[model samples]
Target: MEKKVTLPKHKFHIQAGDTVVVIGGNSKGLRGVVKEVIVEKDRARVEGVAMITKHMKPTASNPQGSLVKTEGSVHISNLMVIDPATGEPTRTGRKVNEKGKLQRFSKKTGNFIPDAYRKQ
Candidate 1:
């Protein structure tokens, strides 16, 4: 008998440092850079995307319990890549520039991602 191997599905195409816009959920229309990508869970944490307040229980670390506000992870399906030039959400595609450098650009804005963090 032959053994069959199954692989998991990966949905989100965006990677860390990529600016994305929230397309669905409670935080719809919000734009932020991807801080982390949880590929196994099909979720990505976007900087300043999902904000939630939690009550922390005091422990040895802190004698006082307090309310904390933190960013929450969003499903990859809810996010769309944002164009660096126009600041609008768009699909990402790679192409070689005049200098033969590989560059990613927004299909909607027709502009390449900023050079500062484009390497990632």
Candidate 2:
């Protein structure tokens, strides 16, 4: 018998497509767009960071195996979302707008972050 694996829903301040800066690890000081949010693993795949090489087996697409480069996930704790308003790193906070809609804001500048996923 095989055990079933389940992924828990994780609410992360940083979402996909948000620009973030690495605060720790070898990728520290580097910035990139958030490609994906790995909620189950508590990590995020940032563009141009934590690159790794993978060897692939020969397939119909290619006659020979090839080495492919891809981005690996960085722990969520090591990332800081960049505030578009200030063009700098900032901590995120949640607030209810005048319309009673939940909004994400930058703690440093006290500015609301425009989120596409959330309808206003």
Candidate with maximal lDDT: 2
Tell me the tens digit of each residue's lDDT in model 1 across 9-119. 653458788878899999998888889899888898988879889999998888898899888899988999877677678887788887898777778866766544555
Task: Return the TM-score for each candidate structure.
Answer: 0.70, 0.87
User: Which ten residues in a row are the worst by lDDT in model 2?
Assistant: 111-120
User: Between which residue pairs do clashes occur in model 2?
Assistant: none
lDDT of 1 at 62: 84
Q: In angstroms, what RMSD does candidate 1 have relative to the true structure?
A: 3.7
Candidate 1: pairs in clash: none
Least accurate 10 contiguous residues by lDDT in model 1: 111-120
Could you give me the TM-score of model 1 versus the true structure? Answer: 0.70
Compute the lDDT for candidate 2: 0.90
lDDT of model 1, residue 2: 90
